[model samples]
Target: MELKGFSTKCIHGGEEGKYEFDVIPPIHLSSTYQLKYEDQDFVYSRVDNPTRRVLEDKMSVLEKGVASLAFSSGIAAISTVVLSFVKPGEEVILSEDIYGGTKTLFMEILSKRGIKYKYVDTRYADRLEDEISDDTRLVMIESPSNPMMRITDIEKVSKIAHEHGLKVAVDNTFASPYLQNPIELGADITIHSATKYLGGHSDIIAGTATFKTMEDYELVKLHRTRLGGVLSPFDSYLLLRSIKTLEVRMERHCKNAMEIAEYLSNHPKVEDVLYPFLKSFPQYDLARSQMRLGGGMISFKLYTDDQDKVDVFLNSLSIMKKAVSLGGVETLIEQPATMTHRALPDEEKKRLGITPGLIRLSVGIENVEDLISDLENALRNI
Candidate 1:
């Protein structure tokens, strides 16, 4: 059957059983599949599992890529893709504002191995070209960047990288395939922490990497196997089930986020709101041009620089839970400096606009008025 819709693809694409059997995809618990003479399909669970393959196939179709690989966690997926291209003494150009774990992987691990990285402000597309050099093999960026909500020009950056013979890797966790498809805009690889939006309920921890061509696919697949970062069959089943409702979940997430952002912008204790959909955002135009939706994440600053005020604001919230990760059915709020980006130097964090007063909000599929009231009450206490 020719699948024509996203939801349809999610529900039917990876499944093999018919109505006589269970409607849901059966979990292939067996670690090894029996093989005929000289033929092997699923020899072992670690190398290949039938259940995991379904999730990979679903992700490949969603991202419009040639192939997809599942990993134990988002960091594992990122490390696999980065290591596939990066070598000792080589360099990578990355955005100043990125996931804390990714930044740590580059600074703490890769740097120890003599692989260097330069953090650039990709908000200015012109600066990207100036930073590229013969040693720069990859350009990594996270659009609607973490904590800051700043967006990079994917098309511009991809074109510049190609001109310099550099490969482009985009972290599409914030703006999932529902909001943006990086490969369609010339990105060589699209990565996601499927633990967040793709898994929707915050029940599973998994990551995915989708490659644009067979060559790139083989490179990442080899790294995944050698590094032993494959996802479990059970986690794959959870992810597959969660992806079926991604479109609907994301729609509500975007709508609720926009409302919450507006409410925060008007609050007395709020200094600034950093949602791309809002007109007050610096990169509003770019966000509109590149993303299909504004997404559920919002980052805002408090008027007070005092740490006491920040504490009061966080403690006053009744509905929005204080949490580390995001993209769940319930709203989540976190302080990046202490939680996500705690490992980075103070100077580097400040350079990337991560401050003590900055708060990252992941608006959930709750009533808009209730979410706004929760924020307003928290601001009142502040």
Candidate 2:
């Protein structure tokens, strides 16, 4: 039988030994459990759920982490982690290329509590180092950054942060656990918007945080419980099912994205293509050193910045949907200026090179020839 591999484990891991003779985990929807003794493991759903616990355990194994906690939404996980590690007076270092929602959360909520945060171009270690201060508690980053495709050197960044006595957290959402594991590269914690890649389908909205140490786990778990952003048992079950096909789905995504990126790079209408696997990518070497595959996300700049042209191109796309989220079986396309990164200031967007012409694509596990033809048809219509 060859003892089955990761792919098989994705389908049947976590509790195989506990639930004998069962092919799949049964959803435990009970909100409370019988406290036969003191300090019961299952007191309330807010604190934990059986389905979520299994999901967390699987994530721990996937990310090679000591422990994990699941959340209702990606923002919920990020917010809880921030609150757990960062204090009002303390500072946290992050990259300028993070998700817009995360940036907004810091500016609006965390900032109100006096917690200062600095955003640096984390692609370079020197720039990231300059942002660190005596009050810095954490260094947060996203590799192949949101909507821009900027790749950060996690190992180098982690090393620098560790030397400074700062905890390191990487948003491993884009790459997913199949492509990259941040904790293995010295990150204290690896975060994911399981709503995206981990779910593998757009059916569920969930998030996860996997920690390298029990102390961090206990802290994040406490915050997760207190914040009350736990995922529902049903959603947890869906996520678990999705994980089974993640490897296959992600492989197709990577292949499709690479071919699409290459196609766009050569297109007369495209100004630039920003995919880590592309040789022209600035961080191509770094991406190779860390990730197994480039994953599904691709960001490209069009030759024209006119809003009308952008709208026309997006509208003409038949296969790709104009959506906000990523990492699904179906392709998603979006204009950062008016979509995901709209909350960002004009000046900041300009500095980050998130021009009006930029288009972020979440390539799906569709046939490559069909996908490319769809792009070609869309470009012609534009």
Which candidate ranks first by lDDT, i.e. highest?
1
Model 1: CA > 4 A from native: 16-20
Model 1, 226: alpha-carbon shift in Å? Answer: 0.7
The TM-scores of all predictions, comma-separated, are 0.97, 0.97
State each model's CA lDDT, in order. Answer: 0.90, 0.89
Question: Per-residue lDDT for 10-111 in model 2, tens only?
Answer: 775665665767677789999988879898778888998888888988888788899999999989999999999998899988888899999999988899
Question: Candidate 1, residues 270-368: lDDT per residue as tens digits?
Answer: 889999999999889999999998999999999876889898999999999999999888899999988988999999888887889999999999998
Instruction: Give the Å shift of residue 267 in candidate 1.
Output: 1.5
> What TM-score quantifies how close candidate 1 is to the native fold?
0.97
TM-score of 2: 0.97
